[model samples]
Structures are given as structure tokens and as C-alpha cells.
Target chain A: MMTKEQILQWLEQFADAIAQNKEYLTQLDAAIGDADHGINMDRGFQKVASQLPKLAEQDISSVLKTVSITLISSVGGASGPLYGTFFLRASTAVAGKQELSNEDLASLLQAGLDGVLQRGKAQLGDKTMIDALSPAVTAFTQAIGQGKTTSEAIQQATAAAEQGMQATIPMLAKKGRASYLGDRSIDHQDPGATSVYLMLKSLSEVLGMTSD
Target chain B: MKKLINQPEDFVRESLIGMAKAHSDLLKVQFEPTFVYRADAPVQGKVALISGGGSGHEPLHAGFVGRGMLDAACPGEVFTSPTPDQMLAAAKQVDGGAGILYIVKNYSGDVMNFEMATELARAEDLRVLSILIDDDVAVKDSLYTQGRRGVGTTVLAEKICGAAAEKGYDLADIADLCRRVNLNGRSMGVALTSCTVPAIMKPTFELDADEIEMGIGIHGEPGRERMTIKSADEITEMLAMSIFEDIVYTRTVREWDESKGGFVDVQLTNPEWEKGDRLLAFVNGMGGTPLAELYIVYRQLADLCAQQGWQIVRNLIGSYITSLDMQGCSITLLRLDDEMIRLWDAPVKTASWRWGS
Candidate 1:
């Protein structure tokens, strides 16, 4: 079981990771986008991080709902609503739960992915956050179905997410600002997918340490 | 990196403060959820017109909010779309019991946020309609892509639609008029230099002195191609010809469906210009370029129109819409029918653009 403390740690770690990789992600976006992905994500996540202390008294569902509201209001781009919806749907899936079982975690991941897919309307291979997030959710559900622990399942999900993120490198972008580049969009790693990978990796790290 | 800013975070707010102060008689600025609304907003029974997008494009959504223009304008951070809360607040502030119309640009963030705002407004039992402006001929329309980016034509649509609203056009009729304006317009721009967002503190892209990015959008997003810079006449010809020769571009757009109480996709096709068509030619400076340069561009554009037997009945030459300090310009050619011509000639009073009463 993953406790509420682990969820808080995962968020804190993910915020730190975003701060560290901010410039790198911005650089990646400079190649094909407006070059503010890192700046925008960091702005939103830092706000989420600052609110963690206040969320301590809240249940898991409420905590995640607060994060979603903050992200949606603070992050002012396509990623804002996309990530906000993910958290909002995840919160709904885990309503009233203070901790998550493996099955609950799987449901959470699936709900979040479904929200992103519905919000962005991006299918697989469209070169978006869905590229990483869809595979990660699938891998997590599969591992959980085979009797894997939450940490092991998240580990498998992170690995799948990494591979999916890399696969975006050569895609001709069919969505977002990069789509304007046409053939020029090829060969640049998608910034949204890269950020999604970081999110899953941070969750895996927090869960892995707790399991140990 | 050199910019006239106190702090990167306060750049947008400070500029907005200055604008609100300067135009106190025209509009009022609301903080926190940051939106600018007309001073005498909630005009009795008038359909409220609201529009928004990222900052840096001055005299756009915000500067154009006044009599005979937008009722409210929500500005996000520099190059970022405003959140749904801002739009919802603006709608509530300006809705006059008739309805609300949101003039949204076709950027991804702007689209999603405005869509959410429409839903929120509807949930509160406030009638709202949204019309998308996507007239940039630069991005090729396709099923896979998000279609074209809305550019210069957005300004024209706002002016025309605002005039229609002032003339007591109903919510649905004004929505159709906005859609009509978008269908009749096409634009293409060439960027001579990359613009630096204040937060980023560097140029969005780097270009050598002799190179120019053709078909660029207003946000400094990379355009169709980068090539060696040419003379003023050649560049104007390139931008103008692309718009003039563009085919009947078709794309799907979402608008509020009153019967379903939600958005529904509608395919729209831009009309092809024939000889002897009346045109409203706009030569817009992309922030850094001067009026003299834009006039020179307009000269070339006017000559091209005359050569092709298209009559340039109306023209607006200056920087009305802009990217931040990007040394470039865009050419927009809008075919005008009788009603559009009358609306274009209608009285408008705003901070950046005003004429007649």
C-alpha cells in the first residue's frame, strides 16, 4: 500500500526534478516550440509544492483536487489544463482514500490517463504527453494485474514511459505549436512527453524508497 | 535580454496597470483573475464581446477593448493563455442579459481554456457563444494537425463583430458574422528577428542578420521556411502572394450549439477571391518594425492588388497586432461584402484604434 506521505514525497520530488530540468526542457522546446515549456511547468509545480503543507490535513482525494485546481489556475498553457484534468480525475478515482492499494493505484493511473486522453484528444503516436502517459498507465495496470507490488508496478510504468518519451524524438508533430513546423518538427523530443516521464519517474522513486 | 521591465514576473501586470491608468476613461482592469472590461460594461441588452490570448501582442485583445470593440479582454502571462476563471469572471462582469460571445484565437491553450470558460458560463445559466479566428495561411490545414493559427484576421473580426453587436445583432447572428469575417480573411507573416519573452529572457529563436523566417505566426513560432533575406518589395510580394493565391482552405471549428447546450464541430471553408473583389488590405508591423516600414509594405501590397484587378477599398497600415519586438510584418487581405464594408467603416473608439464617433 502507498500511504499519503508517499504521495506528498512524490509531489515534492517531482517539483524538485522540474526545477532542475527546467532549462533542459526549455532547450528541448526551443527546437520546435515557443521555448517556455520548462518555465511554465516549473511555475505551476512550484505552486503545487508550496501548497503541500496545507494539504497534509486533507484526504488523498482532497489533496489531489487542490493540486489540480492550483495547476489549472496557475499554469496557463495547454499543459495546464491537460495536467490539471489528470490530477482531477485521479482524485475522483481515489475518493475518500487516505492510502492506496495496488488496485486503487492502477485505477488512479487509468483515470488520469483517460482524463488526459479526453482533454487533449491526442491518440497514441500523435507526439504529446499521451505518448508517455498512455504506455505508463498500461504498463502499471498490467503489472498490477500480475500481482506486482505498487513500487514494482510503478517501476515498470516508468520504464515504459522512458521508452515512449524517446520514441517521440523522430515524430513529425501533428499537434500543438510544433505542428506548424511541418517537416521541421521531426527529430526534436516532445517537451510534454518528457515532462510526463519525469512525473512517473518521480513517483516510482518515492514508492521504491518506501517499499525498501 | 535587454528589456524595459522591473521584474520578469511583474511584467504583464505592470504593463496592464499602465494601460488601465492611461485609458481609465475607456476600460477598467481587474487583477488576480486579470481581465480588462469596458468602462460602461454590462450595456443593457447588448451582447457582450470578450476575447483573450497571451500577452506581448499589445493593442490586440486588451488594447481593442472599448466602445464598438471587445467588451472584455483577459490577458494571461506573456505568451501563455489565460485560465478559465479569468474568462468566467469577465463573462459574469459583462453579460447584459442578452448573451456573451468569446472571440478566441486558434492556439491550443487559448482554445482549451476558452472552451472550459464557455462550459462554466453555461453551467451558471449565462448564455455564451464562442467563435474561433484561425486565418493564418501559414500553417497548412490538415486532419492530423490543429489547423491554422489565428493571426491578423482576429483583429478585423473583433472590430466587425463588435460593430454588429453595437447595432443590436443577436448573439447567434453576431456569432455568424464573426465566422463570416474569419472565412473572408487570410494572412501570412515574415519574421526578421526572434522575439524574447520577458520570462525566458532570451530570443525565442536566433536568426542571422541576412536570414528571415517566412510564414511566422504572431508568437514567433517557426514558420514555413527560413531563407536569405530579400529586399522590402520582394518580401511583401512573397507574403501577399501567398495569401492572395491561397486555395479554398477548409478546416473544422467548434462553436456553441444552442440545441445541445455544448460545442459542436463545424467545417468551414474560406472563399476564394475573384477578380474585381473589394479588399481590405492590412499591413501590420510585428512590434519592432516601424510605421514607415509597414507603409512601404503596404505600397507593395496595394500595387499587387491593383495588378490583379482586386480593388483595395479599405486599408489599415500600422502595428495593431504584434509579437514582442520581432522585426517583421504580416499582410492580411480580407474580401469585403456590402455588410462587411459597412461594418469595417463603422465607428470605433479604443486605446490603439479609434475613428468616427
Candidate 2:
């Protein structure tokens, strides 16, 4: 069973990854965007870390919402709302659960995607964060259906997210500000997809999931 | 890049101080570590209007805060949206019981932050309504596309809407008016060069000297298409015609309709026209472009407008709004009727914008 404490720790780890990789992500954005993707995401995650202690006693859903709201409010750019809505929807979906079952994880992932679709209205193949998230969710759901352990399924999902993130490098952007670049948006790695990879990698570790 | 800023992080802060120093005659500065509001906004009977976004889009959502435009503007870090708490404090300082109107640009961060501000303001029993401006022609079916971004049209819309509010239009009216202006306006932009974001210390995008990007947003985001430089008239034709398609103009007119505020769907379909439509056109500079080039571009745009039978009631050609040192320009056309013309002529003043003396 995954506890609320673990999830919060996972968020911190994800934040740390962003801080460590800030220069890399901003380098990617420098080719196509405003070049603050890493900085903004790092600031938001740091803010989340500061608030995590105050949210320790709260329910997992509430804690997640706090994270969502803080990120959405602090981070500027499309990433803020996209990530914010992801956590908000995920927390709302997993509300009232003290411990999440293997199946509960799938529902949480689904909630996050739904929120992204609602806020970003970005469809699959739009070369957005959805590209990585949808495939990862599918990988997890399929593995769960195969009767694998939750840890194994999440491990599969994390791998899938990493692959999806890498896949964004060659795809042409069809959503957000990058869409305006048309063909030029191609060949550049998506910063959002990169962050999703970081988030999922953190999740795989905290859940102690080593195999699919 | 030879700006007088102390550090990259301190540009917005120092600019706020400069605005206070430069315009002490028109407004007071509130640098409570976040946003700046009008020194006299509270006394202005009409509802307080507020708008903000990432900082690099200079003279926007901030410089336009004064008499007839936004009462206050919250400036975030470079290319970052202000936090909700900052907005909440601004709302309290500017709200005078009449209400508050948030003229939010349709960027994702701006929308979310403004929404949070609305909720926080409501928690304090302040009446707040937000009207999102999505005048960029780049995004389509805005409800379906990644959503329309508020672009050059914001300056024009805010000033006109500001006049209406100053004339005692209520919150609901202000909200609808904001929507109306956004609906009627359409804009397309181009970039001749990329800009360097100070914090990141790199060019936002790479562009060849001869390449010009179409559909460029105010932030240094790449444009819809990159092409070799062409004649000014040819470029103006492309932009003006693109804007013409998005404007849903109609010939249907109501005789002396008092309730509808005298609005008509003025079409710009025919290219071979003597009178296109009454238009408020803007030849907006993209930061590094000079006033002389802007005026020259305006010259071509004016001829194009006339060739299309479009009557130009108002034309603002300058860098009232801009990206940070990006060499480029945009065109905005607001199809107008009698009321719009009257509002266009309304006297207004703000730090970065002014009309009718």
C-alpha cells in the first residue's frame, strides 16, 4: 500500500530533479520558447517542498490539491496550469483514500489526464504533455490488467513515460505557443514531456517498483 | 541589451520604480513587493480594472495602468505569472465596493492566476468578474485550439473598455464589453529576429537575418511561418486579409436600438471595395523595430486598408506594446460601428497609452 507521506516525498524528488536539470530544460526551450521552463518549474516545486510539511497531517487528496494549487499559482507559463490541473484532478480523483491500492493508481493517472485535457484541451498527438501522459497511463493499465503487481505496473508506466518523453523530440508541435512554429517546432525536445519523465521516474522509485 | 537594469531579476522591480518617478503626476505607485495600483483608483467610482502576465511583454498589463485603462497591474517575474496572493492584495487595495474587472489575456498562466484571484477576491466578498482577451488569430476554435492568446489587441480593447467603465458602465456591462472587443478584434504578427531573454541569457529562438516569422506571439515564441522578406504592402495584405476572415461581420443593422448599444456586423469580404469597414488599426512594434519603420509599415497598411474599402477611424502606430528587443511587428483591426467610433474618440490617459488628449 502506498501512503500519503510517500507521495509527498515523491513530489519533492520530482522537484529536485527539475532543479538539477534546470539548465538542460532551459537549453531545450531556448531553441523554441521563452527559455524559462526550467526556472519556473524549479521555483514551483521548491514552493511545493516548503508547503509539504504544513500539509503532512492533511488527507492525501488535500495535500495533493495544495500541491496543485501552489504549482498553478507559482509557476508561470503553460506548464503551471498544465501541471497544476494534473495534480488537482489527480487529487480530486483519489480523495478520501488513506492508502491507494494498485487499481487506485490507475484511477489517479486517469484523473490527471482528464484535467490536462480540460485545461489544455490538447489532444493526443498534439505534441504536448498529453503525448507522454496518455501512453504512460495506457502502459500501466495494460500491465495491471495482466495481473502484474502495482509496483510492476507503475514501473512499466515510468519506462513508457521516458520513452514518450524522448519521442517528442521529432514530433511537430500542434498545441500551445509552440504550435505557431509549425515545422520549426520539430526536432526540439518538449520541456513538458521531459518534466513528465522526471515526475514518473520519481514515482517509480518511491513506490519501490523495480519491474513491470 | 544595454538596459539600465541592475540585474535580470530586478528589471520589473526597477521599472515599477521608474514608472512611479516618471508619472507621479498621474498616479501613485504601490510596490508592496508585488503589484502596482493607481494612487487614486479607489476614488474612481467605476469598478477597478486589473490585468497582468509574464514580464517581458513590456508596457503591457502594467504600463497601461492609470486613468482610463487598468487601475492596477501585477507584474510577475520575467515570463512568469504573478501569484494569486499578490493579486488578492491588489484587489483589496483597488476595490471600492463598486466591483472589480479582470482583463485577463488568454495565456494559460494568466488565465489560471486570474481565476485564482477571482476566487480569492470573492472569498473576501469582493465582486470580481474576469473577461479573457483572446484576439490573436493564430489560435482557432479557441475553445478547441490550445486556446487563443491575448496579443496586440489588448491595448486597444482595454482603452476602449476603460472609457466605457469610466462613463459608469457596471461590472456586467464591463465584462460584456470586454468580450465584445475581443470578439471583434483580430491580430496577426511577424518577427524579423529573435529576442534574448535576460534571465536565461540566450536567444529565445534562432532566425536567419532574411527570414521573417509569421504568427509570432508577443513573447519571442516562433511564428506560424518563416519566409524571406517581402514588400511592406504584400506583408500588410497577408496580415490584413487574415484578420478579415476571422471578423464575423454582417450587414444586419437595427434602427436606433437602445438596448443593444448600436452594434452591427460589418463585413470585409470583398477585396475590390471602395469602403471596406470602419476600422481601428494598430501597427504594433515588436520591441527592437524603430518608430520610422513602424510608420512606414503603417503607410503600407493604410493603403491596403483603403484598397479594401475599409475606413480607418483610428490608427495607432508605435511601440505601445512590445516584446523584449525582438525586431518585428503585428497588425490588429477592430471592425467598428458608430458607438465604437465614439468610444474610439473618448478621452483617456494612461502611463503607456493615451487617446484624445
Candidate 3:
């Protein structure tokens, strides 16, 4: 089971990761995009990080909802609505819960992925965040269905997310600003996918440490 | 990297503060969820027109918020799309009771955020409709890409549709007129130098002194191709030729459907330009280029039109829309019909554009 403290730690960890890799993400975006993905994501997550202290007493759902609102209001790009909707749906999937079971975590991941798919209208190979998010959700859900622990399932999810992020390097972009580049967009890893991979990896680390 | 900015984070707000101070008589700026609305807003029984996008394109959405134009304009960070909250707040501030029409440029962030704002506005029981302006011919394929990026034609559409709204056009009628304007307009741009977003503090891209980037958008993003720099005449020919030779471009667009209570896809095809068509020739500077250079481009553009048997009935030659000091220009050719001509020639009083009382 993933406790409420672990959920908070996961967000804090993800925000730190975004901060640490901010320039790296921007460099990746510079290759195919407008080169502000890192800056924009950092701006939103930094706000999210600042709000986490106040959210310490809230239920998981309320905390996630607050994060969603903060991101939607602060991020101000395609990432704003896309990531905001992800957290919004994830919050809905685990409404009123103080913690998450293996199945509940899988549902949260699946719901978040579904929200992104609907919000962004991107498919599996669109060279967007969906590329990393969809595969990670699938792997996590399958592992949970097979009766894996939350930590084990998230580890598999992180592995899948890494592979998915790598796979975006060779794909042609068909969404967002990168889509404007056409053939020139090839060979550049998608910055959105890279961030989503970091999110899953952060969750995995948090759950693994808690389990240990 | 050099810009007159106090802090990267305060760039948008400080600029907006200055704009509000300078144009206090024409428009009012609101903070928190930032938007600029006409000083005397909510003109009863008039369909309100609102438009917004990234903030770097000055005198665009914000500078145009005044009589006979947009009721409000939401400005996002340098090149980022404004949040939905900004749009929703703008709608609420200037609804005018006749309904609201959002003039959204066709960029992914702008599109999604305005879409969400539309839904939110509807939930609040305020009538809202959105029309997209996607006239940039730079993006060649609609099927494979996000369709064409909205560029110069957006300013034209705002002027025309803003007049229509002033003339008491209903929400649906104004929406249709906006769509019609978009269908008749086509644009292409070339960039001579890169621009730096204040937050980024570096040129978005690089080009040697002898090279120019073609088909660039307003946000400093690289365009279709880069090639060795050519003369003013040659560059004008290239840009004008690309727009002139563009075929009947078709794309599926989303607009709010009140009856369906959701968005419905509508397939729109731009009308083909024919010989002897009357055109509104716009030679626009990409911020850094001077007005004198734009006239040079206009000279060639007018000659090219004359050679093709098209008449340049009206022309707007200047940098009304720009990419924040990017050196270059874009050319927009809009075929004008009688109604559109009337709307285009109508009186407009905005901070950036003002003619006739």
C-alpha cells in the first residue's frame, strides 16, 4: 500500500527532479520544440512544491485536486491543461482516500492516462507525453492485475516509462509545437515524455523506499 | 538576451501595467487572472469579441482591445498560451448580454485553453462561441500536422469581426463572418534573425548573417526552411508567391455547438483565389524590420498582384503584429468581398490601430 506521506514525497521528489533536469528538458525541447518546456514545467511544479506544505493535512484527493488547479493556472501551455487534467482524473479515481492500494494506484494511473488521451487527442505514437504515460500505465495496471505489490508494479511502470521516453527519439512528432517541424522533428526526444517518465520514476522510488 | 526587463518573472505584469497606464482611456487591465478589457465594456446588446494568445506579439490581442475591436484580450507569458482562467474571466467581464465570441489563434496551447474556457463559460450560463484563425500557409500539410499556424490574418479577422460585432451582428453571424474572413486570408513569413524570450534570455534559434529562416511564425519558432539571404524584392516574391500559389486548403476545425452542448468538428476549405480578385495586401514587419523596408516589400507585392491580374484594392503596410524584435516580415493576402470590405473599412479606435471617429 502507498501511504499519504509517500504520495506527498512522490510529488516533492518529482518537483525536485524537474528542477534538477530543467535545463536538460529545455535542451531536448530546443531540438524540436519552442524550448520552453523545461521553464514552463519548472514554473508549475515549483508552485506545486510550495503548496505541498499546506496540503499536508488534506486527503489525497483534495491534495491532488489542488495541485491540478495550481498547474492549470500556473503552467500556461499545452503542458498546463494536459498535466492538470492528468492529476484531476487521478484525484477523482482515488477520491477521499488517505492512501492507495495496488489496485487503487493502478486505477489512478489508468485514469490519468485516459484523461491525457482525451485532453490532448494524442495516440500511442504521437511523440508526446502520451508516449511515455500510456505505456507506463499499461505496465502498472498489468502488474497490479497479476497481483504484484504497489512497489513492484511501479518499478515495472518506471522501466516501461523509460523505454517509452527513449522510443520517442526516433518518432516523428504529430502534436504540439514540435509538430510544426515535420521531418526536422525526428531524432529529438520529446520533452513532455521525458517529464512523464520522471514522474513515474519518482513514484517508484518513493514506494520502493517506503516498502523497504 | 538584452531587453529592458526588471525581472523575467515580472516581465508580463510590468509591461501590462505600463500598457494599462498608457491606454487608460481606451482599455483597462485586470490582474490575478490577467486580461485587458475595453474601458467602457459590456456595451449592451453588442456581441462581445475577445482574443488572446502569447504576450510577446505586442499590439495584437491586447493593443486591439477597444471600440470596434476586441472587448477583452488575455496575454500569456512571452510565448506561452494564456490559462483558461484568464479567458473565462475576460468573458465574464465583457459578455455584454448578447453573448461572447472568442477569436482564438490556431496554436495547440491557445486552442486547448480557449476550449476549456468555453466549456467553463457555458457552465456559468454565459453564451460563448469560438472561431479559429488558421491562415498561415507555412505548414504545408493539414492531415499530418496541427494544420496551419494562425499568423497575420488574425489581425485582419479581428478588425473585420470587431466591426461586425459593433454593427450588432449576433453571436452566430459574427462567428460565421470570422470564419469567412479566415477562409479568404492566407499568410507566410520570413525571419532574418532570432528573438529571445525574456525568461529564456537567449536567442530561440541562431542564423548566420547571410541566412534567413522562411515560413516562421510569430513566436520565434523556426519555420519551414532556411536558406541564404536574398534581396528585398526576391524575398517578397518568395513570400507572396507561396501565398498566391497556395491551393484550396482544407482542414477540420472545432467550434462550440450550443445545440449539441459540446464541440463539433466542421470541415472548412479556403476559397481558391482567382484572377481579377480584389485583395487587401498587408506587408507586415516581424517587429525589428523598419516601415520603410515593409514598403519595399509592398512595392513588389503590388507589382506581383498587378502581374497576376489581381487588384490591390486596400493595403495595410506596417508592423501591427510582431515577434518581439525578430528581424523579417510576413505577407498576408486576403480576398475581399463586399461585406468584408465594408467591415474592413469601418471605423476602429484601438490603442495600436485607430481610424475615423
Q: Kindly indicate the candidate among 2 and 3 with the higher TM-score.
A: 3
For each model in turn, which proportion of the native inter-chain contacts is also found? 0.63, 0.48, 0.58
**Candidate 1 chain B lowest-lDDT run of ten:** B138-147
**Model 3 reproduced share of reference interface contacts:** 0.58
Which of the predicted structures, 1 or 2, would earn the higher TM-score when compared with the native? 1
Instruction: Report the Cα lDDT for residue A201, model 3.
Output: 93
Cα lDDT tens digits, model 1, A1-212, are 88999899999999999999999888888888888789889999999999999989999999999999888888887888899899999999999998899889999989999998877778898888889999999999999889888889999999999999999988988888888898898998999999999999999999988753
**Ten residues in sequence with the least summed lDDT for candidate 3 chain B:** B138-147
Q: Give the distance in Å from residue B345's predicted Cα in candidate 2 to where it truly belongs.
A: 2.6
lDDT tens digits, residue span A61-163, model 3: 9999999999988888789899999999999999978778888888888899999888888888889999999999999989888988888989999999999
Q: Candidate 3: where is the Cα deviation over 4 Å?
A: none
Assign candidate 1 its CAPRI class: medium
Better of 2 and 3 by DockQ: 3
For candidate 2, the TM-score is: 0.86
> Model-by-model lDDT, in order?
0.91, 0.77, 0.91
Best by DockQ: 1
lDDT of 1 by residue, B271-298 (tens): 7789999999999999999889998888
